[model samples]
Target: MNDGLNPAWLRAFVAVCDTGSFTRAAASLDLTQAAVSQQVQRLEAECGPLLIRRTRKASLTPAGVKVLAYARDMEEAHARLRLALADDDPHVGQISVASPGSIGLLLYPRLLALQAAHPGLSVSYRAAPTADIIAAVLASRAELGIVTHRPDDERLRTELFAHESLCLVVPAQMDDVSWPALVRLGYIDHPDGMDMGRRLLARVHPGQRIDQLPVRGFTNQIGAILDPVAHGIGFAVLPRFAVQAYPRRQAIRVVDTAPQVIDSLWLVTRAEWPLSASAAWALERLREHDWLAGADAPASWPAHDNG
Candidate 1:
């Protein structure tokens, strides 16, 4: 916009589009919700045509969609400029990383160790889908990415680090690991959109009704799935790491079946750009994880190979 609108507002507008929630946008920009809303409003005032719809959740107005494409380009260019400047001065630099919530969650604890191992290293974290992580790291928006899937691009170096696999989580006293019982009781599904959960269900029971599970509730959040299951209400198919991290894990029992649901975890970085000391040190520390060093045999997770 040659209208001399603030670049900060433009950046905030783009983050809102990416996150689809003002609250998440606020978190992404490290700003208050009101602040983000005001920036968007300021941008809209310059446009004066209701750029954003501002629905109950989040929706882009017709004009909002039109501008988002270009806005994203601008935001990316700004990041590149910032990185170029930071490269000139090593004293102030940033490393942005994108990861799915599961592996992303575990990686941070290890990242803390990495940070402790090195001082004056600034790290930024973003929770994003697999494809976005691949794209971001490839584009140099992020120097490195901790993702579950491997990128096919030869320009990026990918290493299998740690894995978080699905384990059958049932109540501590519930000894019934029978498929029939699980089928009858309706598996408490965690709609995390992860492949392992779906694949394991297919392996154990093929040609079965997937939608109903007879009658079960679905939750996108892992905690929602684990809480009810841990209380003996129902069983859940979850990553071992997730089960172990559950608040009341002692009340639950893990059934790591022979054909485990394992998704390979990978570390990806652009080959063209050599990692800085901070990033290189972090990568080395990440490689030290014993869990990532080993791969679990998930019956059939061929689809995970695509990314």
Candidate 2:
């Protein structure tokens, strides 16, 4: 309710509630006891109410409790901003990106190589599912998010990060021929990745019999899906990046198919903000790795996916 917001006073107020003593709160804030008391008084006067009960254990009044919650949220936001600021390097600014587990492991090492070149450039990483990564970018919680595939939201600025061949991996012991027969063998599918596989299925073998699809064996972990495939519980689908090595003594084999198809990886970000220097470096490093794999490099970032 105060027209002149006192962020410092809010800090002091929360400190008092946490430490349960004004003297301790003043020490924490490096302010004198009288100054802490004065700030509390001013905050209360502005809000037309008392915030804390002055007793052995400091506690919030009904009004103080409400303000305290808001203060905590504000403090958290400020803390994030401070971290971002601290990441600044003379050559590049700090960037925070959210990505999926598989791609992040495969991709972030590429950025680490760039650290030698762009000493000032730095990157922070967070892991989440595709939908969660999109949400993070939308809320401006991260500068960018590297998702396995493009998000459903049309507003996101997305660019093709990479496209590597993918295959339907099944226990080597279970051999099958053609697309029609593969589905009948029961697949341990990933629910989050079902959409991409849906596209593949639609193209390769439209309307194949899925009666044996094994919807019961579903998981979000790529490794779990692979486990079933390895032990021959059912076939699993995974990107080539997840495979690490071919065959690897696992009783798994790529389904017999021609003209292999691959899943697309996308780097998504807000359309409005200029790409931070650190993020731009990371994006370029990702592109460099893609090119290393004999794929075309991205012409530019901050691109949109019409699909």
Candidate 3:
């Protein structure tokens, strides 16, 4: 019964709610703070005062909360409309995806090739942590999320993508060494390195008394972590995707002494909505793309253990 409630106003309100701050919402929407605030006020005038109160964070009044869901529904409907109509036009649809850095690196080139083929398809891609990727999908900010972990939430659906092998990498100049000797070499820790190191040691050394290994260097960036290790600063545990095509891969050797570890990749989306045609097309290509196509499986690659 709300007449003339502009879609722009609804969009602005949804942006603020999603970001939890007018300033951030304005930034995300590329609108000025005053413009965003004006849209909220305009929306409230049409709907009889939507926001109830404001403190450290924006809290939607009961009316605002009700409106929020409707607003998102409208937004999704509009996006799907564009996608459905875009099929005939080719250039009218947009596809957004969220993924982790290494997977993003692996797929970005392929995605570009896909885009080139479609000419009309536009892509919005972001690389973030696994949790953030899932949040993006749940919030409907991304049409798909390519992730390493399969979330257990009932609201999400997942499809298996691939299995990435994990291996221990050392400076090529370093000789084959034992656990304690490797520990003496120190560690170049990335975000996942510490946990991977702990597991690797447990699997290889069995009952070794080591509580923790010394950390020589640290970086969160996937590709950046390898340079220090290649320079002999320390050793690292990394996925094959991160190490295989590394520019300096030849400078580092993949150690085969440790048992092969594997990480599963998954494609996730909200269960509330079906995939748009554009999303489905891209997902098929992503699944079919040979991620490990040309790359040589390391000689030390171990067979899967049924136990």
Candidate 4:
């Protein structure tokens, strides 16, 4: 028997069985009677003789009965595939997103809330570094990505999503932000700690480099980076969102600096592909909140460059 049986042949064979005659089946299928008969003949040629009687009314042999069942199953499966492909409803599908740990802390809950409100929607969130976030978006693993810096790839579309201030988190007891005070407090490093410290500290401690400070502790976990600081172990530089979400908010203080070091957060997606309805809806929801509202920025502060 032929393995690659044509669907049209199966459709015609099933229609003949339904109408009980090739002439009536041809009328229902909008084809000539000879064409319908030829289709059924082609089906039988592929699957062996399927009809035992060729009278005004059709009769199915045992083989024909089995073929009819298989054809019906194939038709139902094709219908289901069509329905799935046609489902473009924004509220009825999954949306995957990835971002840095600081933003993920804020975003994951918001997405969960969205899922709660719309029970039909499902969410997948990932806390990742900038490079990993970009890779996820490019590989189509994530429909949306939040990165501290804009990606340079031509395949990606990036827009300024929000601004995150680099904050100096010190023990709540420490009021002094003087260079000597920070040096005496030492440093608690994380994945982005050294780079963020260099940027923010450069403004406050003009001549001092981050390496000059002794490393008291290190943790790559965003939530736990401030644990040592809370215990009065050392100071660390972190994004304002991460600092705000910390459970022990009273144990740490964000030191007020002369000029705040703000990092631009970019929303990235595939440039060539249109976003799914659910992904677009989620993106809009994410943009609704001012992520920096209570981060201690001056009302008159102008937006900084992407640098």
Candidate 5:
């Protein structure tokens, strides 16, 4: 007699086991509850009773206990097989990446180039804040995330992607670098300004409080923060990536300070989920980018340690 084993039956069995609820398994697999039940019944017929019923739940029978191990192994093999097939045509898959608006601005050109190089590949990049990027990666909405800070979560695997130096930016015409001149210029505060603000305060006036510093302007948008500074309204401190690409870069320049401030960029992905072939390829490309080498920028930004 034929074993009559089927991948769908195995998938349904594993989904139910993983979810612990047939209803939840059905919803997760996008299959009808009746359909999932039928699939499980088919598997049970093939391998004897697989699940033992309990109040509000189910447990694996001895047979299911054995079958689950084999089912997972089979799923891994299937995933590898799909990956192998995808490798033959790396240009035919999709990968999603999430980054903050500043990083997105710096990465967009490279993303366009990636798509151009592989016409069949689809790339989706979302501009979100660090918190939102982490949430997107955890939710499986995004396969990769790049951000300035890493969270202390065991579920995330982080690597040092790059180091971006912070710079005090003033109107291009502002030539004075004295403390009095800076105090007169005041600070253009934004949502991301707090960290830079604190660092700037420590460097500008040691032992002085942040509230003691003059606040000239305020905004929530990163891109908008630079415009006022460029027009001689007030000065703001920002990451090199955010400032270097501004269309009006010629209008503002980095102010050399006694102690330099730097922000390290981290690449993060969920530790539990294996990357798909396309995502892995994209990640490799990103890893190979020249920025990771950190040669062009001045020595103000130090290399990151361990991740």
Candidate 6:
């Protein structure tokens, strides 16, 4: 009859074969026996004789056996399609996010915990600078991004997600963070070190530029930026989250400043498309942290140990 098999006809045929009786199949399908018989006849019209023995008991021909397997496969595929379309479960999908190294240091563990809690969920976290994060979101490489500043692009929607304080870190043995003291210690610079240093140091050391400090060492790695500082080589400025994650944190001291210098962290996404269920779920989970609420005060340094 037609170019394609009618799903209704195949369903009725499969039901009849499974039940082994027309009356039982009709009851299972919630159809009259006459209606079920008509559907079976329609299937036979499309593919030639299917049922050779149709009495109180039904028997399948060779062609009917082959069609039955394919019909069952189609039913299974249809069920999977319905499940995929009804993607209401937020805890069972993939999410991709990009952020600066400092933010990543704080977020990666949380996302890992989320994935651990929901084994069906998967997370892809990329540690990148502001520019790279923007690029990744634009290119569709990442669905979510975290940046210190709100992006100016019309394509991106940004919301203030958190406030990250810039920290001036010195060696554990150091006590005084006077301008002259910092000058003697020099500056351990990283990619964002000079900028962060200038922003935070500007308040304390008025009229002094960050470049005025000698550059004792340089590292692009967020974790290693504090290494030289921890070893008593020089001082550096870093995000509080990055400072908190250092393995040798006790070796370095975070200098508490009056009128703390803080950077607004923005969550970014494409303006055109709404976030998927998984990404939205992840965003909510990330917002649950107290630090993300911008309530974190400057951390007090541990007492200096001369020994």
- How does each model score on TM-score? 0.61, 0.55, 0.65, 0.73, 0.65, 0.69
lDDT of 6 by residue, 219-247 (tens): 98887888899899999988888987788
- The best-first sequence of candidates by lDDT reads 4, 6, 5, 3, 1, 2
Show how many residue pairs clash in every candidate, following the order shown: 3, 2, 1, 0, 0, 0
Residue pairs with colliding backbones in model 5 are: none
lDDT of 1 by residue, 204-250 (tens): 66655455455455677755677777666777777666665567768
What global local distance difference test value does model 1 have?
0.69
Superposed Cα deviation of residue 260, candidate 4 (Å): 0.9
Using lDDT as the measure, which candidate wins? Answer: 4
Q: Candidate 6: which stretches are off by over 4 Å?
A: 1-85, 293-307
Candidate 3, residue 146: the lDDT equals 78
Question: What lDDT is reached at residue 84 by model 1?
Answer: 61
Q: lDDT at 100 for candidate 6?
A: 85
Write model 2 residue lDDT over 15-79, tens digit each, in one string. 88888889999999999989998888888877656454656867777888888888899998898
lDDT computed for candidate 2: 0.67
Positional deviation of residue 142's Cα in model 1 after best superposition, in angstroms? 2.2
For each candidate in turn, give its C-alpha RMSD to the true structure in angstroms.
15.2, 8.3, 12.8, 6.1, 12.2, 8.0
lDDT of 4 at 39: 93
Indicate whether candidate 4 or candidate 6 has the larger TM-score.
4
Colliding residue pairs in candidate 2: 172-251, 172-252
Error of 1 at 177 (Å): 1.8
Task: State the displacement of the C-alpha of residue 256, model 4, in Å, after optimal TM-score superposition.
Answer: 1.1
Instruction: Please give the TM-score that candidate 2 achieves against the real structure.
Output: 0.55
